[model samples]
Target: MSKVFRSLLLITALSSVSQWAQAGNYWKATAKDGWLDGYVEATLLLNGNLDATSIDTDVDNGVVTLRGKVETDTDKALVQELVLGVDGVNGIENMLTVFSPGENEDSAIQRKLTDKKVATVVKTRLLVAPDIGSTKIDVNSSQGVVVLEGQVKNDAEKQRAVEIAKKITDVEQVVNKLTVSD
Candidate 1:
C-alpha cells in the first residue's frame, strides 16, 4: 500500500477504539454513579421525617452529600448520622436546618419536627406535598411538631408549604415560618 493509504487506515482504527471507550464511560457513569442517589434517598426515606422528595444526593468518588430540608434540629442531627452511616458515605454536610428566615444555616427553630416523638410524622407529610421536594425549603421540629422556613415564589407556595408540613402522620402541629416573594 502507498504511505498515504497506510496512514489513513491507522487513523480509522484508532478512532473506532476511541468511540468504544467513550460509550463504555457513559454506561459506567449511569450504573456506577447511580448508587449515590439511592444511598442518599434510602437514608432519608428510612426516617419517618424525611422522604425521597425533599432531598438531592450527589456523589463523587464515594463521597456523598445530602442537600434538602428537614423539619427540626433533631431531624438535622438524625440526617447527619444517617448519611454518615451509609456504606460509602465519607463526608456529610447537614445543610438541612430548623426553620428560621433570618437565622443562618445554624439557627435553631423550636418545633415538634425537632422533637423526638413526632418528627417522622411531620417529615412524611411534607414529603407528600405537591409543592415541596426533598431538596427545596427547610423544616424544623421540636417536641413532636414542625416548623417550616424557606423562600417560595408566592402565597400559594407558602400555603402549600404549611399544608404539607401539617399533613405528616405524627405531626401534632405546624409552625409555618415560610416567606413568599411577589
Candidate 2:
C-alpha cells in the first residue's frame, strides 16, 4: 500500500471513532435527562395540591426547567421543592407564573415579597433549630401561609418544623406536609 493511502485510511478510522464516542456521550446524557424529568414529574403528581398536568418539565444536563402556570405562589414553590428532592437534579429553573387574573402588578409584587420574607424567616429558624434537619426540609410561603414539605428522621423533627414555622411573625398559617422516615 502507498504511504499516502495508509495515512488517509488512518485519519478516517480515527475520525470515525471520535464521532462514535461523541454520539455515545450524547445519548447517555439524553437518557439521563429523560430519567430525571420523569422522576420530577412523578414527584409532582404524587403531591395532592399540585396539578401536574398544568406544569411542564424539561431537563438538560441535570438542570430542570419548569414552565407553565400554577394556581398560587405556594404551588410554584412546591414544584421547585419537589424537583430539588429528586436525585439527579442539579438545579431548577422555575418559570412558573402564578395565575392571578384580578391582581394588578404592584399588588402581585408586594404579595410575592411578603411570601419571600416569610419563607426566609422560617427557613432561617429551621436552619438554627438544632433538633431539626434543615437540609431535609423545604419551605414555601404564599400570602403569609407557610408550607413545610420533606422527610424528617422522626416525628419530633416534623413537629419541630411546624413549631418553628408557627413562631415566625407574619405567618398566617403553618401547613406541615412533612413525612417521617421509618
Candidate 3:
C-alpha cells in the first residue's frame, strides 16, 4: 500500500473511533437524564403532601427543572428539597409558583387578619416591656412570619424583641433584622 493511502486510512479510522465515542457519550447522558426525570417524577408523586399532577419535571444532564404551580410556598420549597435529595441531581431549577386554588377571598382576608393580630400582639408586648426600647423597633408580620426591623439599644434588647415576637400566638417564625445602635 502507498504511504499516502495508509495515512488517509489511519486518519479515517481515528475519526470513526472519535465519532463513536462522542455518540456513546451523548447517549449515556441522554439515558441518565431520562432516568433522572422518571425518578424525580416518581418522588414528587409519592409525596402525599404534594399535588404533583400539575407539576412537570425535566432533567438535562444531572440538573432537574421543576415547573408548575404549588398550593403554597411550603410546597414549592418541599418540591425543591425532594428533587435535590435524588442521587444524581446536581442542581434544581425550581420555577414553581404558589397558587392556592382553595384559598378564596375569605381565606386571604383571614390570613391577613391573623398576620395583623400577630404583629399587634408582638408590638404590644414589646411596648410593655420596661427594659427594651420598643419605639425604635418596627414589627411586621406576614403569613405567620414576624419580621422585626429597625434598631435596638443593645444586643440584649434585640434578643428580647426576638423572644417577644417568638412567644406571640400564631407567629410561626421570627426574622430579626434588628441592628444594635448602642
**C-alpha lDDT of all candidate models, in order:** 0.62, 0.80, 0.80
Where does model 1 exceed 4 Å of error?
A: 49-53, 100-182
Q: How far is candidate 1 from the true structure (C-alpha RMSD, Å)?
A: 12.4
lDDT of 3 by residue, 18-128 (tens): 999999999999999999899889877876556889999999889998898977654665677567656789999888888864355477875775666567667756866
Q: TM-score of the candidate numbered 1?
A: 0.46
Give the per-residue lDDT of model 2 (tens digit) for 135-177: 7889999988999998999988888889878876668899999
Give the residue spans of candidate 3 off by over 4 A: 101-182
Best TM-score goes to which candidate?
A: 2
Clashes of each: 25, 0, 0
Among all windows of ten consecutive residues in candidate 3, which has the lowest summed lDDT?
101-110
lDDT of 1 by residue, 51-90 (tens): 4467677776666666776554556665665565455566
Each prediction's TM-score against the native?
Answer: 0.46, 0.59, 0.55
Candidates 1 and 2 compared: the better one by TM-score is 2
